[model samples]
Target chain A: MAELLVYLAATLVGVAFLLALYRFFKGPSSADRVVAFDVLTIVSVTAIALVALAEGRGIYLDVALIYALLSFLGVIVVARYLERGL
Target chain B: MDIVGGLLLVGGAAFLLFGGLGLVRMPDVFNRIQAGTKATTLGTLLGLAGIACLQPDWALKLFLIGLFILFTNPISSQVLARAAHRSGARKSALTAVDRLEEDHGA
Candidate 1:
């Protein structure tokens, strides 16, 4: 039953990731693209965490944390670059 | 592990799907941020809580992720919004209620 929940979560999040990717590719404005990127990051982290559960491993939590940090860094970098006056 | 957790997991997934759909359908960047932050935050909280419910021993780690996400998601959204404003991403065609452009008008 637990594994079933994990699989369901993963599938739904995978679909969400696909949607984020669609927005990332189709967004007309730079800010739109940036938001899409941020959504993608969040989805990816969620996916990793779900995978961790299915695997019954604690290590994937560390991976999810790392992913979270990296995504934050990516947002900061992209935000700074797009700020135009920086 | 139990039905409660499963419900949370399913609910979270549904919230995520909504966020993604909203992102594509929203009118502007600001609207996008609003949808993205609220849905993702709730979805993530539900997802992590479900997992924590299953593994009682590692609840600490799961809770940590949830807390970290709660702390950071809003902060990053604020940063992004500020950057967008300071970078002049707003449209001149927008209504006059924008606080970010109040003093910058010609």
Candidate 2:
């Protein structure tokens, strides 16, 4: 049951990732692409969590944590650049 | 317990999918950020909760992850919106308010 759930969630998130990728590429403005990128990272973190459960591994949770932090930093830096400031 | 966890996982994934749909469909950057941040944050919390349920021993760490998400999602979205506005991304024509503009001349 748990495995089935993990698979289902991962599949759904994969679909979400595709949609986000489309927006990232098709967005009219830089901000639009940045927002799409942010959504993609969030979806990836969720994916990591689901995969960790499916594989019965604890180490992947740490990966999720680090990924989340780095994504936050990336978004902030891009936003700052968009604002034409440091 | 497993069944409950599975349900949470499915529901969270559904929310996540909706967020992505909103990102594609929303008319403007602000609306897109609104949809993306709210839906994804809730979805992520639910997904983390489901994992906690499935792995009782990892509950504390999962909780911390969820907490981090809750705090950061809104902050990032807010900063993005502010930067978008500062960079002159126009709002949708249908938008009702310009208070932020009137107040700060943004």
What candidate 2 gets wrong by more than 4 Å, as runs, is none
Q: For candidate 2, list the clashing residue pairs, or say none.
A: none
**Distance from true position, residue B105, model 1, in Å?**
4.6
Can you give the DockQ of every candidate in the order shown?
0.68, 0.83
lDDT of each residue in A3-77, candidate 1, tens digit only: 676677778888888888999999777878889999888877778877887788879988998888888878877
Model 2 C-alpha lDDT per residue in residues A4-86, reported as the tens digit of each score: 87789888989999999999999899999999999999999989988888788989999999999999989999999999977
* Fraction of the reference Cα-Cα interface contacts (below 8 Å) that each candidate reproduces: 0.59, 0.81
User: What C-alpha lDDT do the candidate models reach, one value each?
Assistant: 0.81, 0.91
lDDT of 1: 0.81
Candidate 1 residue-wise lDDT, B1-106, digit = tens: 5777877887888788888988887777877888998899899889888877876766798788888888888888888877777776755355457765777741
Clashes of each: 0, 0
TM-score (0 to 1) of chain B for each candidate: 0.88, 0.95
Q: Which residue pairs show backbone clashes in model 1?
A: none
